[model samples]
Target: MMPLRNPKHAPAAAAHLSRSAGVRHQGTKRSLSAQRSPAAQRAAPLNLEIEQLREKGNAAFKAGSYSIALQHYQEAQGKALTCRPVDDDLQARILSNCAAAQLHLGQPQAALQSCKRALQAVPNHTRALGRAVTCHLRMGGFSAAQGFIDALRAQPLTQAEANTCQQSKDALQALVQQALARAAKAATAEEGVQALAALEACLEDSHAPCMPSLLLTKADLLLLLDRHQDATRMVLAASEAAGWPQERLERYSKWVHAHMLYSQGQLDKAATAVSEMAEAAADDECRPAPALLPSRSAFAMLQQAEPQAFRDLAQSLTMLHQAKEEGNNAWRRQDKAAALNFYTHALEGITAPPPVFAAVVFASRAAVHRADGRLLDALADSLRSLALCPLYMRGVLRLGQLLTDMGRHELAAQELGALQKEQAAAARAHAVNATCIDLWRDVDAALKKAKEGQRQRRAIDHFEVLGVPRTLCTDDEVKKAYRQLVLKFHPDKALGRCRFSSAIHTTCRPSLAQSQLEERVRAQAHRVFSMISDASTALATRSSRITLEAQLNVAQYRTASQQQPYSPGRYSGAYQPRSSTARASRQNAYSKTYSNDYYDSDYYAYERFWAS
Candidate 1:
C-alpha cells in the first residue's frame, strides 16, 4: 500500500495534513483504519469531517429547526453509508440519528426505514430499536412497536437506556389501555359500528401484539356489537386466518362463551359465566384491570324492572298491529266504515306511537274517508299525517287529493311539488329505494293545471282603509290622510280623555264584566291605532303608494263585477264630496261629533273612544 492519501484534498494537502494529522487524530496511538485495505481507507474520512457534520446536525435539531436538522442528518447518513465500514458503530449511530430527526419532523414512516437500516448494521443498537418503536407507535402500528420494544429490552442497556426501555414499554401499554377504553366507551355510547371498527383495527394489526388483554377486549366488544359470529371467529380463529396459540385461545374462550350465552337472552347465565373470567383476569393483573361484575341484587333489580317496560312497549305494539290488520282487512273488502273505525282506533290507541306508524294510520284513515267522499274529514286526517311525517309519500299524495277535492287546487299542487323534491332527495341519499320520477311527473302535471285554474285573490284595498281616492291620490295626499287618521285613533291621545257608555257596565252598575269591557275598549283603541300606523307605513314611499294604487284598482274591479254599480248621485243628497280629501275630513269629524249621538248605545258605545 502506497500509504493511502487523504480522500479529501484541501487548498494545500501537504500543509493541511501537517496541521491536522496529529491534532484531529491525536488521541489514537494507532489509527482505527491503520491496517484497513486501500478501499476501506478511502471509503471514510481520514480527518474529522463526519464528526463536524453530526455536531452541526445536533445544533440545528436543538434550535427547533427540524427541516434544517433533517437535511443535515440526511447528509451525515449519506456520507457514513458511502464512506464508513458497513457494520461500524459510527455507521449505526449516524443512521439512528437520522431516524430521530425524522421522528421529530413527523415523518415516522421515513424514520422507521432509517432505523431498520441502522439495526441491520448493529443488531443490538438500542437507540435505533427505541426509535423504531416510537415510529411504529406514531403510525398506530402497535404490533410492530412491540417487536422493537421487546428486542430493545433484550439487549444490554446502561441505566439511562434501561429507563428508556421501561418508558417505551409503559407507553406501549398506555396505548393498549387507551384503545381499549375508547372501544369500551364507544360500545357503551351505542356507537356499534365504531366499536366494531376499533376491535377489528387492533385484531388486524399482527405485528403489534399489544397484549393478550386487547384481544380479550376485542371478543367482548364484538359480543357487545351483536357480532356473535365475528366474535367467535376472532376468539377461535377461522380456518383461513392465522390462529393465536392454544393457551392464549383458552384465555379468550371464557369471555366468548359468556357472550354466546348472553346472545341466547340468558342474562343470568351470561353474568355468571363471565364472573370467573373477570376474577381470573384480575388475579393475573391484566389491564385495564378488571372490575367485579354487578352483584346478584343488581341483577335482580334489573330482572324485576325490565319486564314492565318491555310489556308496556310490547302491548302498545301488539294493539297497534291488531288495529292496522283490521283496517287493512276492512279496506280490502271495501268496508269503508269498518276501515275508518279501525284506523281511528289505531291512531288513538297509543299516546305516542312511533311517528312512522302513526303517520301510516293517519294516511290510511284519510284514504278511507277520501273514498267515502268525506273531503273535510279526509283533509283533517291527511294534514295530521303530514304533520307527523312531512316526507310520508302516501300522506303527500292523499293531502294533494284532499286539497283538490276542497277546491284548493293551487295549494294541492304546491304541496305535492314540495314533496317531489323531498322524495328525490330521499332517493339520492339511498334512504328510499323507489325513484321519485313518476311521482314528480304526476305532481308537475297537476301543478301546471292548478296554476292555470288558480284564483288570483284581490289585494286588500289600503286606499279604502285610509279613506283616499284610488286614482287622485299623490304621495302628499296619502301621507296627509294617514296623519289625520293616526291623530284621531292614536292611543296616546285617547288614553285619558276617552269616555265609556253605561252600556259598558252591562251586568251591574260596575261589575267585573264592566272592567273587562273597559279593558276591551282600550284594546280595541290600541288595535285601531296600529291599523292607522300600518296605513301610514303602506304609503310612506313612492313605490309602496304605487303598489297600493294598483291593489285598490284590482279590488274595485272585482267589487264592481260582483255587485250592482255604486250610485254616487243616490248618496249625494245624504252628502258625499267629490274629493276623498274633503270626504275624509268629514269622516274624521264623524267619530268626534257622533261621540254624543248615542244610537243603539250598546253597539255604538265603544266607537266613541277612538277613530276620532
Candidate 2:
C-alpha cells in the first residue's frame, strides 16, 4: 500500500533529485572558475615582473654594462623558475644575455655552457642559436660552430636575427679570403712578417684559421725576424691544434727551433737543443738531426781555440780584478801592513807584462813614506811612479809635492808646469774641472818654494841602487841580487815588505810603521828603491842592458851637447836648469852638482876602479 502511493510521486521525486545534482554541479563549476581567476591575476603580476626584469637586463645590455645585464637576466630566470612552469622563450632570452656577457668578458667556456643551456630550452630560438654559434667559434670549435650556424639558418627567425647569422658567415668568409690574399702577396713579395700578421688575425666569430701550412709559414717568417721563441711557440701551437703526434710535428718545429738558436749565436745551446730533441725522438723518430751544432773533429778546433782567442784575456782580467779587490778591501780596513802586503802580492801575480800597475802601487807606498817622515823614500817612489805613468794625476801632484819637500824645487816646478798646460787645454775644451784652482795653487806654491830653495838633492846612479859591483856584473850576479831583494821584500811577507827596519816597530807597531828614519833619510831610501827597480829592469834584458850601458857612458860625458834637452822615460822627468844660459854654463858645475846627487860621482869612481 505504501509503495503504490510513492509511485504516483516518483516523477516529482526524480525531478527534485535531478535538480539537486544540477545545483551541486553548478557549485563545483563556480569554485573551479574562482580558482582560475586568482591564478590569472597572479600570472599577470608574475609576467609583469619577468617583463620588467627582462627590460632592465636589456637596458643594462644597451648601456654596455654586460655584467649587470647578466645579473638582471639571471634574476629573471630564477623568478621564471619559481613559477609553476618556466617560459621557454624567456629562459632562452636570459641564457642568451648571460652568454653574451661571458663572451665579451673573455670567458668563452662559461659562455659556451650558457648558450648550450639556452639552445636546449628553445631549440628554434634565434638569439640563443646566434649566441651558441659565436661561443663555439670563440673556443676554437670550428666544426661545431658551423653546425650550429646551419641549424640556426634552418630555423624560423626574425629578419634582424637572420641578418646576424648571415653577416657572421659572410664576415668569416671575408676574413679567410683576406688572410689568404695577404699570404699570397707576402709570399710573392717576400713580406713574411705581413703574411704572418694576416694569418694570425682572427675574425670576430671564427676559430683560429692558422692551419699547419700557415703556422709553418709564419714560423719561417718569425725565424727570419729573429723571433726564435715566438717561432717555437707558433710551431708548438700548430702541432697541438693539429692533434698530430709530437714526433711528426717535431721535425719541422725542431729544425726551426734549432735554426733560431743557431742564428742567435747559441751554437752550444743549439747543439744541446738538437741532442735533446733527438733523444726525445729516440728510435720512433726518423727526422734527420738538426743542422745546428757541429761536434766534429774540425769544430773541436774552434772549441779549443775559443778559450785562447776570446776568453783568455777576459779570464786574466777577472783574476786581476779579484786580486786587486781583495787587496783594496784589506786596505780599507786600516790594516796597513796587510794592505801593502796584499798590494805587493797583487803586483807579482799580474800577467799582462807591463809594470803600469806597479807604478800605481809604488805611488801609494810613497804616501806611507811621507806619513812616516821618510822624505827620501817618498821622493824615490814619486820618481818611479812618474816614470811608470806620467799622466797619472795623483802621482803627478804627489811627485811635485815630494820634489818640493826634498829640496828639488826646480824640477817640481817643471813637472807642475806641464800638468798645468794639459789642465788648461782641458778647460779650453769646456771640460768641467773642480781641481783647477787647487792645482794652480799647488803649482804656484811649489814654484815659490823652488825659487826660495838654495840647491836640489843629488840623483842616484844604477849600480849603487842595485848593491852590485858597478863596472862589470854578470847577469847571474844581477839575478842573484834581484832574487835576494825580492825574497826579502815580497809583499806577502809582512816583515820583509816594510821599507824601514824593525827599529821602527819599537817606535810604533810594524802594522802601523812605514819608516822610523828622518825625512831626509826616508827620501834617500825611496830614491834608492827606484834606482834598484831601474837596475833590475835593465839587467833583466840583454838588449836593454846594452842600451843602458850606452846611455850611462853618454851620461858620463860633460860635453856642451850634453846640455841639450834629455828626454826621460814614461814616468819621470830629468832635473833641468831654468834657462838656456844656465844650462850651457853648468858644464863645469855638472860633476860637482851630481857628486852631491850620490850616483854620478859614485859611478865615476867605480868606473876608474874597474878600469884599473
Candidate 3:
C-alpha cells in the first residue's frame, strides 16, 4: 500500500477550517498511516516541531521580543520549507512574517525583497502589501509606498487594520508636508527666517520626531540666520544624540566641527578636520562615500579648504535628486498626494542656488499644484517663478498653462504669442511650432469652461466650507464654530498628522470612531480642556472688569543746592542782612503754624486724608 501524506501539513485541509477552528488529531490508526511513508513519517515530527516553533515565535512577537521571535521564525521557515513542499498561501504567509521580523530588525532592504516575494506568491495579501509600503517608505521610495497604501485601502480592512492604515497614512502625510515646507523655504532668498520660525515650532511640538537628522537641519538653518553659537550648540547636541553607527556619527560630527572651525578662520585646524572627516566619510557605509565627490572637489577649492562646505553642498544635491526622482515617480503613478510631497521635498532641497534654480523649484511646485487640480496655487507658483526669473521658459510655459486653465485665454494667447515671438527671434523653429498653437487654442477654450465652472463653484461662501448654519449664530457660538473649523481645516491638520480622534474627542467625542480612535479622541479632548482652561481668564475679561493694584511709597529728596539755612547772614553789625534761606525758613514756620490753625477749623472737619 502507498504511504499516506500527513494531513496536518495539507493547506487544502486547513482551508476547509476557519482560522479560529480547533484541530483534532485522529488516534494510532492514522499515526500508523503516517509511518508507512518514510518521508511523511520523518516530516510529521518536523512539521509538528515547526508548528510549535511558529506558535512560540508568534507569542514572542506579541510580547515585543522581536529578536527571539525572529530566531524562531527563521528556524521554522528552514524546517518547514525543507520538510515538505508548502502550498502557495503558506509560503506567502511565511515570507510575509519573515519580512515583518526583518523590518523590526532594521533590515528594510531585506524586508522589502521578502515582501515582494510574498506579494508575488499572493498578490492580494494585505499583510505583505502593508509591509511593502512601510519598507518602501523607509527606503524613500515614496511613490511606491503611496501606491501600496492606496492598494491596501482599496481592499476590505478590519477596524483594527483600518486604524493602523490610517496612522501610517497620517505619518507619511506629515513627513511629506514637512519636507515640502522645508524645500519651499530653502528655495526662497528671504524666507529663511520665516522657515526657521516654522521649523522651530515643529521642533517645539513634543509629538514630532526630534531625531538627530532634524536637529542637523535646524543647525543648518541657524547658520543661515547668523546664529553661529546656537548652530554650533545644536550641531554638537545632535552629534551626541544621533545614536547612529559610529562611522555615521563621526562623519556627521567631523563635517560640522570642520565647518565651525572654518567659520572661525581656524584654517589650518579646519583643513585638518576636513581631511579627517573626508577619510572617515570614505569608510562610512550608511551613505555612499563616492557620492561626496562633487562636494569634496568643491571643498578642495575653498580658500580655507573647508570640507564641510563641500559636504553640505553635496548633501543638498543628493537631496535634490532624491526629491526630483520621488516627485517624478509620484507623477508617473498619478498619485497627487505623493507627488505633492516629493515636489515639496525637491523644492526644499535647494539651499544655495542661482536664480534659475528657484525658477526650476517653483516650476516643479506649479506642476504639482496643477496635478492636484489646484489651479490658483499652480498659477501662484508659476507667477512667482516668472517674477524671479522672467527669462525662465518653463515658468512662462507653466504660467500660460495656468492662465489657460483659469479661462484667461486672452492672457494665455498673449503669453503664447510672446513665447513664440521670443523663440522665433532666436531662430528656434521648434518653439513656435503648430503644436504650440494647437496647445494654446485648446488651453484657451478649456480655461473659458473652467472659469464658468469656477464661477458656479464660487457661489458658495466660508460658511459652506464648514457646513455650518449661518442663521443667528451668537458670538459665543460663532467663536466655537470657528475653533472647530480651524481644527478641521487648518492646513497643518488637513495636510499633516492631526490626530483625527483627538479632533473628535475635543470637539465631540460621541461622534468618534470606536476602539483605538477613542484613545486619541480622549487625549485631544484633554488637550482642548487644558487650552480652554488657560484661556478662561482672558475670555472672562472680555465681558468683565478686572483690576490689579500695587502700593509703593514715594521718597522725597532735597539736594544740598536746594536746602535752606536758618539765621544765615553774609554780614552782621546790628545792621543785619537777613539771608534768603532765613526768610524762607521763617515763612515755612509761619505757614506750618497757620496751616495747623486752618485744619483745626470746621471747614475740613473729619475728612479722610486720601493719597492718589
Candidate 4:
C-alpha cells in the first residue's frame, strides 16, 4: 500500500491514537482471546510500530528536520491505515501535517493537494482551511483565496486563527489592486509608444512629465527630418524637465541673481554665492547643458567670468575686507605702523575696487598720514578720495583738517564753509536725513578753528625755521642748524624749565586755577617743541627737503594770491639770508634740478628712504 503523507500535528495525534489502540488490544487479547478477531489481533503489533514511528517523527519535526519528520510521519500513517479500522479524525490531522511539511519545503502545489485531501477527510478541518488560503494567496489566486477565506471564517476558530484569516483576506484584496495598477502602467507605456509612432507618421509638431528616453528619441527624429529649430527647442525643453538640465537651470538662476547683486553693488553677498557655487561644482554631477553654460550666455560678460576665477576673486575680496577691518582696529588702538601696513595691504590686494569702497579706504589712510604730520600726503589721499566719491563726508572733513594743519587755514576755511552750506542745501532740497550729525559737528568745529588760525597765520618756512635757505642747503648744514636749535627747544630742556618754574612756585601753593594755567603753558611749550622737531627732521635729508620745498612753494603760491604778509617771530630774528643774487641763483638751480625727479611719500618709498 502507498504511504500516506503527514504534516504538522500528525505525529503527536498518531502517537496518541496508537497508545489508545494498544490499550484496547491488550484488554481484548487477555480477557477475550478466543473471541478476538484476527484483524484486531494483527492490528495490535501494527499499533505499537505506529507509536514508535510517530515519536521519531515528532522529534525530527521539533528539531527542524522537516524532510526526515515527513518521512517518519508517512510511515506512521501507513501503519495506522493497516489497522482494522482507520481513525478518520487521525487521518485528517496526519494529512494536514503532510501539507504543512510540504508548505515549509516550498512545494505549495503539493501542499494544496494534501490540504484538499485533509478537508475531504474532515470537511471542517481549520488547519487545512487556513493552509489552503495561504497557498492560494501565494500563487496569486485572489478569487480562490477569497473562497478559502469565506470557508475559514465559517468554521469555529480561536482568536489567533480568526485574526490570521482576516489578515489573509486583506492581503488578497491588496494584491488584486497591485495587479490592476501594473496592468494599467503597462497600457500607459504602450499608449506612449503608439502616440510617438503616430507623431512620426504625421510628421507634425507635438509636445511631459514623459520619460527622458522618449523625449530624446523624439528630439533625434526631429533632427533627422531637418527641422533643426524645432529639434533644438525640443531638446531644450526635454533637458529643462530632466537630467542635468534641471540642475543647470538652478545654477543659471543663481548666477543671474548674483550678477544682479553685483550690479547693485552688493559685493559681499554676490561673492559669497560665487564661492558656494564653485565648491558645488566639485561634485560629480554632469556638466551644465551646452546652451545653459555661462560661457555660452550673457554671464560671460561679467568681471572674472570663469567660475574658478570668480571664486578666487571672492576669496581675494574677503581677505581685503579683513585687512581693512584690521587696519581700522589698529588705528583705534593708536598703532600707526600696524594700521598703515594693513591699509596698504588692503589697497594693494585689489587692482580695481568699487569707487565707494576705495573712497572709504583712501580716507582712512589719509587719517593715518595726518596723524603722522605728513600733511602733503594726507592732502593728496583726501583729495583722491573725494575725487572717487565726491559726496564722501569723511574725506571732505579730512581734507579740511589737513589743510588747516598744513597752515593753508584760509583755504581750509573756504572749503569747509562751502561744504557746510552745500550739505544744508542738500538736506533742505531732498529732505535727506542727516546721517552724519557727529561728522557735521566735527566739520563745524574744524571750520571755526581754521578761521581762527587764518586770522593769526605766520608764514614760518620749515627751512627758515632751521636757519637754512629754502634751497641749496647741504644735509650737513641742515643737521648743524637743527642741533643748534635743539639745545634751546628740545623736549628735555622744556621739561627742565617746567620743573624749575614749578619748584619756584611751590613755596606759594598754587590754586587749581593756577595749576591749570601752568599746565596750559607747559602744553604750549611742547607744541612749539614738536613743531621745531618736525622742521628739523624734514630738513635733515636731501630728498625730504626737496619734497618739503616743493610743498612750501605750493603753499606760498596759495597764500600769495591772498596777499598774506609774513610776520617776524623770535626765531625769524635769529635767521639771516645769503645775498639776493646768490640766493636767487641757487633757488633757480634747485627748481630745475629736482622738479621732475621729486617723489611724493604718499605713493613712493618714503618709509624706506626715511629709515635709511
Candidate 5:
C-alpha cells in the first residue's frame, strides 16, 4: 500500500469511518487527525460566502450600478482575505473592479492609480491592463497608454476580448501618430502652441514614443510665438532624437534654422532657408498637401521685402481661394448659404472689389433679406452696395428711386446722397476728367429740382423770403437776403420805423405776438435757410444732368429775389471768386445776395408801400 496520505489531502476518507465499519487494522497509524480547529472549520464556509458576494458584485457592476457594486466587492475582498490568504489573481481582479468603478465615476486619477496597483499584482490581468490604458490615455498619457495597449494585445484572450483590445490599440496608435506628427512639424509660433497642448496631453501616457515630430512641433510653435531661443533648443533636441528619417530631419532643421533667422530679422537667410525647404518639400514624395501651402506662403511672405511682402500676401490669398475652391466644390452648386460663407471669407482678404462684384454680393444679401420679409434690412444692404460703388448706378437709382416713388422721400434722399458722394470720391481719386465733374454737377442740379418740387408741394417756399425764386441762388445769397428782410419786418423796430405794422400784426399774431416777433422771424429765417441748404445739397448730389438743370433754374429764381439789384444774374458773381471769409459771412447771414424776381411790381404793390 502507498504511504498513508495526510488527512488534509484525503478525499472524504476519515479514520473514524473505517473504525465504525469494524475493519480497523493493527500497526497502521491513523493519518486523519480528530483535533481540527474551529477556525479551520469556518474557513471553507467563509470562502463560499465571499465568492457569493463577489458574484453579486459582478452582476451589479455589469448592470451599471458601480457604487452599489463597489460596496459589495469591497466587502467580499475583506471577507476573502480574512477567511484565507487572497491570491494575487484575486487581488488584481478586485482592484480592477474598483478601478472600473472609479473610472465610471469620472475620477480618472484615482482610477489610474487603482488600475496601476492591479497591474502590479498580476501583470497579465487583461481587464486591469485595458482599464489602465484607458485611464492613462484619458489623462493624456499616450505613451504609457500605448504600453498597456501592447501588453493587452500580447495576451491570450478570448476572440471578443482580443478584437476589442486590437481595435482600441489601433485607435490609440492613430492618435499617437497624429500627435507625434504635429510635434515634429511645429515650426512656427502657432505650431508651437499646438505642440505644447499636445505635449501636455502626452505627458499622461509616459510610454509613448518621444517622436522627433513632437519636438519639431514645439520648436515651430515657439518660433511663431517669438520664442526663438527656446524653439532652437527644442529643434536641436528633436533633431537628435532617434528613428526619424534623415530627409525629414534635415527638412525640419532647415525650417527651424530659417525661422530663427527670420525672428532675428534676417530676411535674406530666411528666404534662403525657405527656398531650400520648398525645394526639398517639392521634390520629396512626402510633401505636405497643397492646402497647407497658402499658410506657409503667408509666413514666408512676412520675411520678404516690404512691397514684395504685400505682393506675396496677395498671392497667398489667391492660393487660399484656389485651395478653398478645391476643397469645397459645393460652393459652386448654387448653395446660397455655403456661397455666402465662402464669399465672406474671400472678402476678408481684400479691401474693395470692382463695382460689379460688390453689387452682386450686396444684391445676394439683399435678396435673402427681402425673402425673409426684412425690407428695411434688404434696402440697407442694397444701399450700402451703392455707397461702396456708385458706378452701380442702375441698382442705386432703381432701389431708392422706387422708394421715392413710393413716397419714402427721406430714405430716397439718404440713398441718393450716399451714391453721389461715393461716385464723386471715386472719380476724384481716379483723376476723372473735368467733363465728368461737369456731368456730376448736371446730375446734382436735376436731383435738386426734384427735391424743390417736393418742398413746394409741401406748401412752403422757405427760400422765397429773400426776394428770390427757388432756383439759381447760392447758399450765400439765400442767407444774406433773409437777414435783410428780417430787419425790415422786425416788430421791435422804432415806432417811426414800423412801416408794415398791420402786416406784422397779422403775420405775427397770437401764436407769435409782437413781443415774440423776433423769435418768429428767427424761426422763419431758419426754415428759409434750411430749404436753401437742402437745394444746395441736392444740387451737389444729383446723378442726372437733365434733372440738375431744372434744379439750377429754381435756384437761379430764388437767388434773383434775395439780392439788392433783384437781378437773376447778380448772384452769379457771388460764387465766381469764392473766398473763405465771404463764404463764412454769407453762411452766417439770412441771405448774402438778393434778386429782383420776388420783388415784381404785383408783390410790392400788394405790400402797400408806406414811407417810414
Candidate 6:
C-alpha cells in the first residue's frame, strides 16, 4: 500500500488503477468458483475505488490544485465510511491526507479537527500527531501542542520527521520572541499588559527555550509600570534561567532598587544610587549591554528623578547612529531589504532631527531604491537628502547620475557643474588632496557625458520633434505644427508650471523659500522650449526646407535598404497616396484665392465645421 499522505506514490497508483479500470471495462469478471468469499467480493471493488480516489487527490495536491485535491479526499473518505467492516488503516490515511490538504489551504483549525478524527481511527498515528502539533502551534496554543509533541517524540521517527519537527519549534520560538519585543515597545500600559497576557498564555508550556527572553521582557514591562517587587522577582528568575553570573544580576538589582526609590519620590536618594550603579557599570567586566539594561523606559523615569544625568537628544541620536551603521553593514552584504528596514528605523528613531545623519541615511536608502529599479522613488529620496544637506557630495553625485540615466541631460549637467565649482574652490583653499582630485575628475567626466547627451538630443530629426511629415508637409503646415508645439511645451504654459504657479497664488501665499522640485521643473520646461525653437529655426525658409527634405530622403533610403521592406510611413518619409480629383480641386482653389485673409477664413470655417 502507498504511504500515508505521500504524493510521490500517485503516478504508480494512477497507472495501476488505469490498467485495472481497463480490464473491468473489458468485462473481465471473476467466476463465482474463482472468488474468495462473499464478504471479500462485496468489499473488493469499493476498496479499489477508494484507493483510486485517494491517488487522484494526491496527484491534484502535487499539481497545486489544492481545492480539487480537497474535494477528492472528502469524496474518498465518504466512500470509505460507507463500507461495512470498514478498513481502519485506509480510513486513517485518507483523513490524515485531508488534514494535510487543509493545512496547505491555511485552514489550521479545520486541519486540527481532521487530525483529531484521523487519530481517533488509529490512536498511534505518527503523521496525525505531527500535523496536530503544527496546527496547535500555528494557532498559538503552544501548551496544548506540548502533548502532541511528546506523543510524536515517543514514536520511532525517521530523520526527515525529526528535522521537520525541530524546524517547527524554531519557528515558534522566533514568533514568540517577536511578540515579546512588540509588547515591550507598546505605547500604553494597558496595551502592553494585554500584549503581555497574550504572550503568557501562548507560553505556558515550559518546554520552549524562549522562556528566558519572555521573562526579561516581562520584567522590563513591570518595571515601567512601577511594580517594583514583581519586576525584581522576574529579573532574578530570568537571570538564573539565562545563565547570567553574579555581576549581571547585581547590576539589575541595583537598577530595580534605584527605580523603586525614584517611584516613591525619594529623588535625591534615587539619584545617588543611580550614580553609584553608573560608576560600577563603568568597570569593563561589569558593564551591561544597552539592550540588557532596558534603559528607554527607565530613561524616561530618570529624566524626572535625575535631570542632569541623561540627555534625551543625545540618547536618541546615539540609537539612530547605531541603526545607521547596521544599515551600512547590511548594504555591504548586498541585503537590500534588511538595509532598507534599518535605514527606515534610523529615520524614525530620531527625537530631534540631525540633518547630517538624516541626509546620510536618506542617501543610502536612495541607493537601495535605485538598485531595486524604483527610479522615481530613488529620485525623490536623492532630492530630499540633498535638500537636507546641500553640500553632501555623495547625494549630489547620486542625483546627477540618476538624472543622466533618465535622459535629463540638462539637469544632470547643472548638478555636476555645481559640484565642479565646489571642488575647484576647495582645491584653491587648501593643497589638493587625492580625494578632492578624484571627486573633481568624476564631476568633470559626468558633466562631459551629460553635454554629449544634450548634443545627441539636439541632432534628432526636426520633423519628428514637431510631429509633422517631412515628405507631405507644406510651409503652412510646418508653421502650424511649430505654433501648437510651442503652446504645448512653453515654460509659461506647461502643466506642472501652471499648477505650481496656481498654488503660489492660493494656499501657498507668499513665502521667501521656494521648493527645489518646482525650480527643477521650470528649468526643464525652459530647456525643452529652447530645443523646440531651435528645431523650428532649422526647418524654416524655402532653402532650409529643401535641404532638410533631400537629407531625409537619403537617410530613409539607406535605412530601408538594410532593414525590412519599407512602407509609406512616418519614418520612411514616403508620401501617402492622394486622390487626383481632390489634389486638382485643392490646387484650383489655392490658385484662385491665395491670400492670408482667405486662409484665415478657411481655418475658422473648418474649425466651426468640426465643432458641429
TM-score of every prediction relative to native: 0.31, 0.29, 0.29, 0.34, 0.26, 0.29
Whose lDDT is greatest here?
6
Report the number of backbone clashes for model 3.
Answer: 4
How does each model score on lDDT? 0.53, 0.51, 0.48, 0.55, 0.47, 0.60
lDDT computed for candidate 6:
0.60
- The candidate that achieves the highest TM-score relative to the unseen native structure: 4
lDDT per residue (tens digit) for residues 1-612 in model 5: 011111211111223222322333341333312222344433344357767888888898778887887788788767656645345556676777777766565445566676788777667665566566555544445556546655644233466645654565566557656765665555444554676688657533432223434444445455555565776666555444322355755655565565455333334444556555544543353232232222222123223223443344234434433433532454446465665555444334333222234444554555444544444335444554444334655456545543443234555566667767876787869956676666556456545644654564422223332344444555566556556645643334422121111110111111112223333334433433444445344433212212333344444455455454655675575534455675557434413233333344433332222110
Angstrom error at residue 571, model 4: 27
| Candidate 4 lDDT by residue in tens digits, 1-612 | 001112233333233322321222232134433433454444434367777887887788778888987888787777767665655555666777776666555445566777898787678666677667555533334457446655644244457645654665465445334422332232222443453454343222111112232333444333323233554555554443343445554554555455444333355776786676675564445244333221212233222234576567577556756787899999999999999898777665633444456667778998998788665446556765665556777888998887676666787898799889977977678745556667788989999978976776633357644557777778788778767766765545533332211110111111112243334435545654565677877676777776666556655654564576556562464555446676567546646765545555631342232222
How would you encode candidate 3's per-residue C-alpha lDDT over 82-162 as one tens digit per residue?
744444455566777787776665555666787788777668665677666555544345456546655654344467645
lDDT of 2 by residue, 140-209 (tens): 4555755665564434446764465457556665665565556444422246566666667632223433
RMSD of each: 23.1, 27.2, 29.8, 31.6, 28.1, 28.2
Off by over 4 Å in 1: 1-153, 156-322, 344-355, 369-391, 405-410, 419-449, 452-612
Please give the lDDT score at residue 384 for candidate 2: 55
lDDT of 5: 0.47
Candidate 4 at 305: error in angstroms?
A: 7.6
By lDDT: ranked, best first: 6, 4, 1, 2, 3, 5
State how far residue 158 of model 5 sits from its true place (Å).
21
Model 1 lDDT per residue over 335-418, tens place: 999998898776665333334466667788878877876554465556555654566676788778656554456677788778
* Stretches of candidate 4 exceeding 4 Å from the true structure: 1-267, 279-298, 301-307, 350-352, 429-435, 453-612
Error of 1 at 587 (Å): 30
Better of 1 and 4 by TM-score: 4
Task: Name the TM-score of candidate 1.
Answer: 0.31
